[model samples]
Target: MRSIAIRLQELDDDELEDFVDIWLHNRSALYYRTERLGKTSDKGRDVVGFVTDQLHEGDWDLYQCKRKTRGSKLGVGEALKELGKVFYHHLKGEYATLPRKYVFVSPRGITGPLQTLLLNKEKLRTALVDQWDETCRTGITRNEEVPLSNVIRTVIDAYDFTRITYLTGTLLAKETDAGPALSKVLNLVPDEAPEAEAPETVCEVEMVYLDQLREIYGETSGLAFTTINDVLAHPVHAGHLQLQRTRFFEAAAFDRFHRDNTAPGAMETFKKDIFHTVIEVYRESHPSRLDRVNAVMKHIGMTQVSLLGRMSRPPVRQGMCHHLATDGRLRWTR
Candidate 1:
């Protein structure tokens, strides 16, 4: 497995631009609607991300992508030229207002001189003003001297130059959220199960034992127990009622087991295996025909007690015993 950064570094210019678009979408979809601009008509922006408040009406951010080869860095002149486009467009009323942020996206990354300028807002502004004549002046205007107003200058001075930031290929490649985009770009199979937080709640089935007990008590006593308290108070059904109560607390542990085991139908298979294990325990007890139902119940409870050997959940054993007595093939008394 090649590292994501190393793989990203290998992408050509066109692919890198597309990958950055996807990366931004994955990374900031909650806060921004990412838009990719065409190469020639883009007017400088390779991608523009509008804040989620209301399309272009809200604040916006800009991205300029460069796919430079290894050892090549973004020059100061090139950086200045890109910055000029934002100021130039705002002056011409091409934008409603200047972007809240202006980011440079590149695989090769910015040169040392540009990186130093980016460290301090005042220094970066000074560098931009100094280089305006050579790099930005012509790019901002083709025909005549573009009048830069004092108001625009005040806005520029107040503008957060710190908003000018860089996104390196290494950072993009290492982002966990950007995995799908990177995999798409590299033409690799995506991970089937990326790590995610466990859900706060797990779905549950209605109490299986409670339903069975109601059926059993009705058959034995000519009336079904209408409430849980009635079932617990009934002398014949009291033990099984206690077992079902214990299972409610044990639900969280069972849910974790179900989630940890990834096999399909694993929960059903686990229940089936538990039933078989209980049956084996019952058969080994070998209660005699002379044994009454009460004696049989006691024999199973005592002799078959170890059926739950080393099990994490003790309440599960009680539920299994209830199942065996009521519904399982194992007869309480022959």
Candidate 2:
């Protein structure tokens, strides 16, 4: 398979713009709305991120996308021209205020020299001012030259050049949160299942399943089981209770994780599959409630859950029983 950066470099200009819009929505929590300005006369903004309810009047960020061939990097001239457009247009009052950030989005990334200039905010500002007469001044408009006038220079001086940044396809691929968006746009597989180790401390959300287990233990062991400590004191039931809790929490984590990563209702539908698969076994008679629980677990091991693909591990499915039990859907003792 082609690497993510290589694949990104292959997308047409419109595709790249649309993807940056989607990717920004997924990756950033700051924006209330995002738009891809695809028209040629978009006044220098390719993608706009509206940060506040005031929309253009309040605060926004500008994303300028450049789709280069696989090996080529964005150079100082083009970078300065893009920066110039925003500043020149802002001077003409194209929008209410300058953007909170001006980002250069490219698949091939900026050249090493440009990267060094960006790292030093003062140097980048100097480069922008020095290069404006040739690159930005002419390129910002066909009709006239946008000189680096005193007014423009004052705005640039007060403005934080440090807000300028770059995002490459390589940096984007490293974001685990972007996995779903990448899969949707790039047709890549979703990232691998995240680790779901059960926490050592029991959480309040486990109360429902723990209650069921405690009551079931009382039925088999002939004890009152009023408190958790009482149950823990029992040599036999204590270990069993711990294992059940572990399974329940692990399954809970797995369900929460896949729900966020997979398609809508996927995890819910998978849980439903487990319930139907085990409802018959759960209805059968057993010597004790614990025996019934164990039987249902064994049944799920042999059965198949095709909904989640490789994500449906044995422990994850087994934990679904407690998922059902917590919602009053399945009860081992009842």
Candidate 3:
């Protein structure tokens, strides 16, 4: 397996920030809104996660991204300057409140000096004050030299140093492993299909698909298959009915599992892909409605859809046609 660290090494500064943006979406309960404050003198925020609806005016957490080269790490000089920008902008009223958390994000992480300061809040605060002139003064703004006055000193002294922290490349790579963006950023392995068991009897929700199936059965056999019991009485049709219903339930389970694990609308996006893939086949001439159903089911096996790494299953592919049928997006008879 290729290490995620190697994958992280490939991204540039902007790409790293973009990944951070995608990563933040996983924390929905903690942050109501998340935004990437990209290049353009962004007041020190590379990425922001706003916990409240009040946005920057209220509580927010800021991430300052640094994509360091291989074997190199972020130094205290660059880190302090970023901190200065956050406070300087706050002092200048760019935002009403200070960030609840000030995080330094880098591919290689921070150097020992910065890491030491971060662990000790008092030392971190003292280091910021001491390094203010050398690191932060001229670096914060291109124009004027920011003098560390009493007001600025007061803000620094009062501000919480514990909020300052960092995330190493290795830690970040581990995080991306769990979310939907993992495949987007790095190569993801496919999952195996599970056994899909059908229910003993027909359920209300399966009616739409079963209804379509009944019509196809009646059209082919020339028998009045009016009810679920009527279809169950036929040995041949009953066996086919069980298999089709299993496919439907397998797809339902697939959808439910992905909804819980993958990104928003992941299953829906896959469903749409499957619909477009087989819609042309559904429109084509077939011998009978039952043949049409079988043709669509067969088409899915050969056709490609954007399969989620976790939801890659044979039954899932077959079930999507039934799902589309239930949704009225595809008619097996027509």
Best of the candidates, TM-score: 3
Least accurate 10 contiguous residues by lDDT in model 3: 184-193
Q: Compute each candidate's TM-score over C-alphas.
A: 0.57, 0.74, 0.80
Deviating ranges (above 4 Å) for candidate 2: 12-23, 26-43, 46-60, 92-94, 141-150, 189-201, 219-224, 234-236, 255-295, 304-309, 327-334
Per-candidate local distance difference test: 0.61, 0.80, 0.81
The predicted structure with the larger lDDT, 2 or 3, is 3
- Estimate the Cα RMSD of every predicted model relative to the unseen true structure: 12.2, 4.2, 3.8
* Tens-digit lDDT string for candidate 3 (113-219): 88898899899899889999999889999989997889999999999888888887787767733455454455443344355678897889889889888888988
Q: Give the clashing pairs for model 1.
A: none
lDDT of 1 by residue, 1-334 (tens): 7776777777887788877677667657555688888476576678788886665567888878877777787878988878877777676667766777888887777788888888777898988776777877676656666444565566667778988988777777666666546645775433322222223232234344456555556556776677656766788677654544455335334534433322224434445555565554445543432223333335333433221122324444334444444444444442
Candidate 3 differs from the real structure by a C-alpha RMSD in angstroms, to one decimal, of 3.8
Highest-lDDT candidate: 3
- How big is the positional error of residue 37 in model 3, measured in Å on the Cα after superposition? 1.4
Model 3: runs farther than 4 Å from truth?
A: 176-178, 187-211, 214-238, 252-273, 285-288, 302-312
Relative to the true structure, candidate 1 has a C-alpha RMSD (angstroms) of 12.2
Greater-lDDT candidate between 1 and 3 = 3
lDDT of 2 at 225: 96
Give the TM-score (vs. native) of candidate 3: 0.80
